[model samples]
Target: MADLSSNAPPNQIWVAVKKQKVWIASGILLLLVAALSPDQARDSLGFVAQSLLTTAPYLLLSIGIAAWAVATGADNLIARAFTGSPVLMIFLAALAGGLSPFCSCGVIPLIAALLTMGVPLSAVMAFWLASPVMDPSMFLLTSGVLGFEFAIAKTLAAIGLGVAGGFIVMALAGSHILHDALRDGVGNGGCGAAKIRNPKTVVWRFWNHGDRVEKFGKEAFKTTLFLAQWLTLAFLLESLMLAYVPAETITSVLGGTGIGPIAIATVVGVPAYLNGYAALPLISGLMEQGMAQGAGLAFLVAGGVTSLPAAIAVWALVKPRVFTLYIAISLGGAFMIGLAYQGWTLI
Candidate 1:
């Protein structure tokens, strides 16, 4: 047999490597970690493996749903469902987002699907801004750790933050200030408007058509690969973050009153986020250490919405403009919500 493994041209090989950049970066980081400290490397890799295992079921479901939408042509229905009543849709999205089951990192699939399906960015923004903050289980956990009042306040904060952010996007869109939401090569899309111009009739029984079945398989595989690569990198970075950053360092800076501390908390929350389950106890401990109530709320809201992992996933899905607006809304609303909550506590 002729050894013809290097068949691809150099440029094509470079393009392929660029596409796999996240995986390459992940490998490099791991190698560096292993070289520097084998124990830390082992711990971080273990964390990534465990996180992936925990997230597997949700990832599979998301992939299946995404693939199903494409195969069955049900994406049009999804668009109509979300865009039927724009104002109502935004409100409902915010409300539903509070009860969403997805975690900060897991919400990316739906966000991408909604954008790809041409769902109005306003409603999607509402859902997008809110989904990461609080779920029913998180509410319970926050209640147990921080107290029922604080949990209720956080839940309300999630809904309110989303509603406000949605309307802001809607207003910007009205002024033509908002840019095209999705990125290139995301999904049957360049911009959502162009794709939804000629909506296809959804065939619920898509399996009856061989082409549809093939489409489903391809979509599923592509989605699975895309999500897996990004998710692995997200988890790997998250693992490193948790291992290196100390809780005391985070709490120390956030433990003071006024807008100054709240402002600092919002900024710090992005890099310092320890995930919902771990952060509650940490925040609770910080409160006992004199962390301002406002700072705590700001930290929680900011971290939940724009944590390193969640931000990375969002960056992968949307254009830079949309991502910037998303971060702006998160940071601004988190601070305001914190101020409002602080006022409420004073009263």
Candidate 2:
């Protein structure tokens, strides 16, 4: 008998079983709801399914492009190019982060590596803060769902956040405040430096190396699965919200350009927001219901910066004071941007 255990990961098995359970539970819940209220169940389920279909292509393409970038050693090239003056490096790091297609979780290992490589904390912080806000894949999808102006504004906001965070950290450079920041000096190393064996033969040998090919395939597939699961869950939750939550209620609360509304949006966003990929449709729905553009943007920025996953990753790697500063910069920058946008629109 072939030993199948060596062929797949143990966690994968658990994940598969958990997914099966989710499907089973969802089916049973749907059946029960149908038994109780057939029309409501039908509408909600249909909306959920539609939402899944709508976002599938973007999610797939984003992960695929991101995976390819890693496999081709392009991300490494970008990471290694951040050596320069503080201002220049900070700007470049922010730009790279905006362009790189990575979530907060995905960027943690790179961050560790960069720090270990002696990259300035300022530049590392710049990239760390910027990368999760927007990427090529997210930009395309956001442009499609929202407007071009909104997408452009988001990209700028991400870079701006990175710049602000980087400069702030630079200012606190010699202070004892950030002296105890790094909790760990290394990461799991799974996402460590990408090594290109032969630059000239990379194209022809890309598909020839069995191990490399396997690695890329596994990564791409895993990414697809991870994103699809989140997207599906988010769509389902959105469907329920749309069905149960009154549109007028959301609008009345978040429709204003006042500091109060923007502040609420930012604070609420820290806990309420999900992954960037999952939050788009929900944000869109809220916008359609009359949410202010400034408030919506603030919510996205704050959540992207201090999201649970991202915050946890940072907390695990850094000390209390550094984490506090990270949160402060993110929150403060988000509010300023939102307020500025509101002012721009008024003028």
Candidate 3:
């Protein structure tokens, strides 16, 4: 009566997948068009090259900001002052988050630091919710691609998400909502949080520390590489969409100011959004194809908040309830903002 399943392989096999997703995707895309003539293949390569070129400026900008943020330890320093009234702390954290140059991945260490330092969960929630949406670098790039007004609106929306998420988390304090947030090794200085030191001293004597220089070099390279991979994927996908997806089809579904289109955009954004930098060019193309402004904005917000990488980072640090609430606030805020923007356009 030996059970056959006892000697079977473990159901969850941990596969060590390489990080060459862009290369793999590009290879598959080329294979899909392998039947094309040489000239068509050349044209397809040209499209991808052009897409890279189009995103080059933003890529450079993002690299610079990411490098500076890491070197200065500015984000962690900002979170050190989160000991005030709940409302004020939330506002400060959210504001600092909106201004920070870190992406969702970059913000994880800072969030861990705040939680470990006993900063209110509400304030940390605000920063965690807000930091991914916009930063100075993103603002400039968005302005260049989507227009100044759109950039401004999106920045405001980022801050708004922080404030709203802060208040809601604060209101739900003392319930099961805030329980068991700091999981094992999450906030106990495990996420590579920065040490607090005087900024002026660090900046003035920056070259004296060989260790920091080495760390900075590694961080700079890592940040740049990450951006290149995601952006390449984004550019390739956008090129395909432009070449294949009909403009009328996009416009027909996403071009309206009605609640239907807004809701659809929000839902689609959760899974479809790539990165804030990549979303710009895609959003630009969608707008050219007659996407409504409100819908486009909704998509950006939803995607930023619910991006797969970002969500995974948050999930690593908090319990299931807190993670679900994060998503709910992001979706609700995105939808409400879209509706409000659409209403304002009529005024």
- Which 10 consecutive positions of candidate 1 have the poorest summed lDDT? 188-197
Per-prediction TM-score to the true structure, in the order listed = 0.60, 0.84, 0.84
Score each candidate by Cα lDDT: 0.75, 0.76, 0.76
The sequence of per-residue lDDT tens digits that candidate 1 reaches over residues 211-302 is 99999999889777776676666667756656676656655776555778889888988887756655665576567656788888899999
Error of 1 at 247 (Å): 13
Superposed model 2: Cα runs more than 4 Å off: 1-36, 103-106, 184-219
Residue 130 shift from truth in candidate 1, angstroms: 0.5
Model 1 error, position 97 (Å): 1.4
Candidate 3 per-residue C-alpha lDDT over 1-347 given as tens digits, one digit per residue, 9 for 90 to 100: 22235454443221212455566776777767656545555666787688668757766776776776667655455644476798899888788777766545556666676677677888888887777788887887787778888888888888889999999988988888787777677745444354422222335344467866666687778877776766666666666677778999998999877898889999999878877877877888888887888998999999998997778878978888889999999999999988888888767
- Which stretches in model 3 have alpha-carbon errors above 4 Å? 1-17, 34-41, 103-106, 179-187, 191-217
